[model samples]
Target chain A: MSSVSDRMLTSDPVVEVENLVAHYGSHKVLDGVNLTVNAGEIHIIMGGSGSGKSTLLRHLLGLRRVTSGRIRLLGHELDGVHRSELQELRKQIGVSFQGGALLSSMTVGENVTLPLREHTRLDESTMAIMARMKLEVVNLGGFEHFMPAQLSGGMIKRAALARAIVMDPKLLFFDEPSAGLDPVVSAELDELILRLREAMHMSIVVVTHELESAFRIADRMTVLDCGKILISDTADKVRNSANSRVQDLLNRRPRVEELDADAYLARLTGE
Target chain B: MPIWMHGSWMMAETRLGRVEQLGKRTLGLIAEVGYLAALLTESLYWIFAGVFQRQPVRVSSVFAEMMRTGVSAIPIVFLLSFSIGVMLAIQGIHTLRTFGAESQVVIGIALSISREFGPLITGIVVAGRTGSALAARIGTMVVSEEIDALRVMGIQPVRYLVSPVLLAMLVMLPALTIMADFAGLLGGAVYSAMDLGISYAAYADRVISVLKTGDIWQGLIKSAVFATVITLIGVANGFSVTGGAEGVGRATTRSVVLAISGIVIADMVFTWFLNR
Candidate 1:
């Protein structure tokens, strides 16, 4: 496992995005977004709903193609990477989706061990031991055999986290880790994430709207608004930034943009 | 331009737009067909690759799907095929009796069931039953991001999800069709003995004499094609689902409709080719 740490300690950027643009059909969801995540650091991407943070995360993961931009993960540019190369690159990264996304047909233990089974020729016993170790790391040691449907919301998140990190990936991504959890459970998850980063020595990129969790776990935070990055700095610097959009987001203020009556009428009339 | 002329110009432009939309939809349908064919080719490649690489097909998943798509469908297929057989016999009797050839009813029923009705009915039933289920299952997985999750885990969804089900359908649909054929013959026998004043032995002999092994083989071949069409359409529709629950519902409906239509069209082509 120290080999994983050794690999993770490289000075190269774990994730790099430059001038990234993305679209859902004709409408742009990410406009000229740029980000960089360094080794062994927890980078929090924070934004309100529809702020393109998730879209950015998807692009970083190579799950979505960029309309125009560069995404370099672990020194490999993703723009024109072949399918096999992209898959090989993805093997070094792990993503925990917002909904857990564990296969309902498989038990939690099976879900956690799926990557090992697919990518490694390890014996079943070894895979089981590794899966149990990860579950223990996430405080789900004894509940590995439980079905995902039987788990509580907090437990499901923990199980998903265990599955994500079972391969000891160099770069880990979390999508709203604290969503749908109580305050106490959310805090516990935050602690688990921090501990995982320290123990595994991996770079982490978290997409979240939870301000408290963001501030608590982020080594550096990037705030995005309406498809553009407002600020990318240390937590305190981001909180203290002069940008009105950053301040509004941090203070939970409703954004008020004056509507144009003529535009509104034209939209209603399908013009 | 004058106001009246401008209105007419707008109307003409709208008609042109509608035509363009229709053309785009036609092209989209063709693209979808091409995509599905590519997916099928890729799935076959993976299956063979797995075999050569010693990564055997997931036996447990294939067996589970076999039970779901094939074994569990027996009762409904039986009922449907039996009813069709009985109806064909009754109608054949009525038509033949007018010409003093009511005994030919057995030949008509046997030929129709073995060469056409059995596979077609089995396909339609399985399309409604297993095809919709496949679409909904995969659609829900898509909606919940599980497919993306699998991709993130370095597991190709086509290999893990579609291949086993495809293999299962290939194995099972023909098996179900055979069962349907037998049930249909039995139903025809029952109808003939009870009402048509025909003996069971006479009816069986007539069926055996009039029906060739080639007829059964053709029907089985058609079932295999129907199986591929049903599962491919189902999985393709599932993968294409967007939004959420509503998307899953729409995918399920589309899978069933598309599978049934594809099966019938395929049946027509197979019948023509096999008979010729």
Candidate 2:
């Protein structure tokens, strides 16, 4: 399991994006965003609704086509990398979507073992053992046979986490790991994420709008608003920043904007 | 332009807009055909390449699809084939009876069922049943992000999902066609014996004499083509799905409509070739 990532220096960037610009039709979704996640770190990207955090995460996962700039995952530039090469690189990276995305057709155990079956030739017994080990890591022990439909929302998230880490990815990206849950379950997930970083020795990038969870687990935090980075720094610095928009986000204040009569009329008339 | 001239200009603009829409539709169809070809090619590659690899085709998934696409479809195919078979025999008796040749009904039943109705009817049923199901299943997966999960896991969705279902369709559609043929024959036999006063032995002998190896092979061959068209269209429509639950419904409808059309068009071409 030892690889170049293990030997990399602490400051080495595992995930890097520079001047990344993206669009959905005529609307700009991500506007000149720059971000980096160093080796063995938890970098949280936090933003309010429609702030382009999801789109930025999609770009990092190589799931979206960008309009400009560079996205380098572990050293491979994703912009025009060969499909096969991208797939090869994907073996070392994992993603958990906001929805658990567990195949409804399969049981929880089968879901966890899916990546192994597709990509590895490990013996059946070994595969089972490794899947169980991952489930235990996520505190889902002895629930191997349960169906995903049978799991609670929190449990589904944990199960998705188990599947994501089953491959022991060097770079893990999890989307909204605490979006839907009781406060206690959300805290448990926060703790699990911290434990995962400690044990797996991997860089993790989490995308979320949950401020408390973001501050609790992030080694460094990047705050994005309306497709631009407001601040990228440690938790304390980001909170203390003098930026008005960042403060607005932190204090959960309502945004104020002067109305433009002509533009507003055009929008209303569907022009 | 003057106000009076603006009328003709608006008319011309409307005509041009229609043409532009037509052109876009034509291009969209062409792109969908391209998508179908790519999906089939990748599926075939994995099916062949899996021979050297250890169970890359995922036999369990294939069997599950077979149950849905073939085995579970047994009752509907049987009922339709049998009813069509009986109607064909009755009509043959009526037409031939005018010339005192009603006894020849077995030849018509045997030939038509084996050469035409078996594959065509079975294909229509499957396009409605399994084809729509395929689209709905994959469309749901796309909306739910399961497809993305598979992608991020380094597994190609077409390879992991489409290939196994395609293989199942390839194997099971032909088997259902054979069953359809048998059901049709039984229906004809029962009708001829009871209504036309034809003996069971006489009907069986006549059917055996009329049905040729070429007839069975032709039906089987058409079933294979129909199977390919149905799976390709279904999988393509599923991948093209957008939005959410509503998108899945649209994809399902498109898959059924397109696959049924493909079956009929292919059947027409095959019939033309046979006649030639």
Candidate 3:
């Protein structure tokens, strides 16, 4: 396996997020998050449930509006880009959702070829060949004829990955890639992520809560807590951090805070 | 003020709040309708742009939707229209007999079925069946993040998802109405012969004489408009879905209700205009 130094050849950052703030109605989810992903590196955004990692991912993908912040993807600022330009920008990015998000009505092959069919003027034969090649890359070879419903959880994830990379995007995003998969399958997916970086030279940003997967695959990682980033550095630096919250996360220890009884009662009763 | 007086004052304030809430809800409903109109306009823009730009229409998906929305609906539409036709004939017979104008029963059934019930009943059936299904399917897709996936692929959801279904509805609704009209007329003829002792030839002659081509055209036109309303409402609700599975269910129910109501209102407008 190539070291992080070898893959981080270019200093150009494919993704630059600065002081990003986001909200869900009245509730704030991401609070001043700053992140950068260098070209050809795998950057993992790891946090517990409701830690705003998913919200950050949504903002990065331009699926959600940022409350206050700047997000630059492939050198284009997403904050005020026109709709047509944003769409054109999206063609250079790929995302694999947590649930795979493959169209249930389409076969795996059809799903993979959808982007090409919509955007390219390639003949049907060329499109089919390209789709088959992507399926093979994700270890989903010969599964093209099957519907998404027929695939297992792991296969579904792989199929979604295949579709995401079918266009060979400059930047790729994965939301919980190894989630709900067995350890063996998860490890295989880790290997696939590494190979994709090596083969495609594409920057990858993955949002996950799986520490093992994060440690294994991330060239760099960010740890988010309560919608704020506690650490964003090399994986080794994050693992060796002296912060109690970071340690608690690394050691699988629950955060236990001492509470005042009166305050707790007041909060519960909205007094 | 005394404690009792304060309590009464609080109750009055609560009642005032309720009235204010009602007004707010009414305004919210009007806003939603305005938003839906905007969505319809955007969808129409994409549809026309696709046509003029020679974009590839997904023929297979449109055909599949046609099967689901039009073909699968045949049995229920036929059965319902047949029953309605029989009931109309029976009622017409009893009422006309009282006035010694029983022979006009055939004309009454023919005119009403062709000009009104044929399209209205077809629209209602489709709203309950295909419109609800469209909303549920797309709402589920939204909750599952499939819509986001499409966006990441640089494919517009309106073009990829809504357009094909819209095209299918446009083509199929009118066809279904024509089938329904024929089936209803057939049912009326059978009832006239068996229940009223009127010969089939006499009933057919009366229907042919009373039913103008203009009436059939009016029903077809009404159905076409209803098709647009049903599909636009369904796709709009689907896109607006939030939460999860429960949200999908709510959106589906709302689509059906709004589609049926919109169809009825559109029918009235079309009837008045077309007749005038």
Residue by residue across B51-118, what tens digits does model 1's lDDT show?
66544568888999999999999999999999998898889889999999987888889989999999
The digit string of per-residue lDDT tens for model 3 on A1-271 reads 2476455746778999999999899999999999988888899999999899998999999889899999999899998899778878988999999999999989999999998888788999999999999999998899999999999999999999999999899999999998999999999999999999889988899999999999999888999999999999888889899999999998999999888999899989999
Q: What TM-score between 0 and 1 does chain B of candidate 3 receive?
A: 0.90
- The candidates' DockQ values read 0.67, 0.65, 0.77
Estimate the Cα RMSD of every predicted model relative to the unseen true structure: 3.0, 3.0, 2.2
Off by over 4 Å in 2: A1-9, A260-271, B50-55
Reference contacts preserved by each model:
0.74, 0.80, 0.86
Candidate 1 Cα deviation (angstroms), residue A131: 2.2
Model 2 residue B269 lDDT?
98
Ranking, TM-score, top scorer first: 2, 3, 1
For model 1 chain B, give the 10-residue run with minimal summed lDDT. Answer: B50-59
**Number of the top-ranking candidate, with DockQ as the measure:** 3
lDDT of every predicted structure (CA atoms) = 0.90, 0.90, 0.90
lDDT for predicted candidate 2 compared with the true structure: 0.90
Worst 10 residues of 2 chain A by lDDT: A1-10
Instruction: Give candidate 1's error at residue B262 in angstroms.
Output: 1.8
Where does candidate 2 clash, by residue pair? none
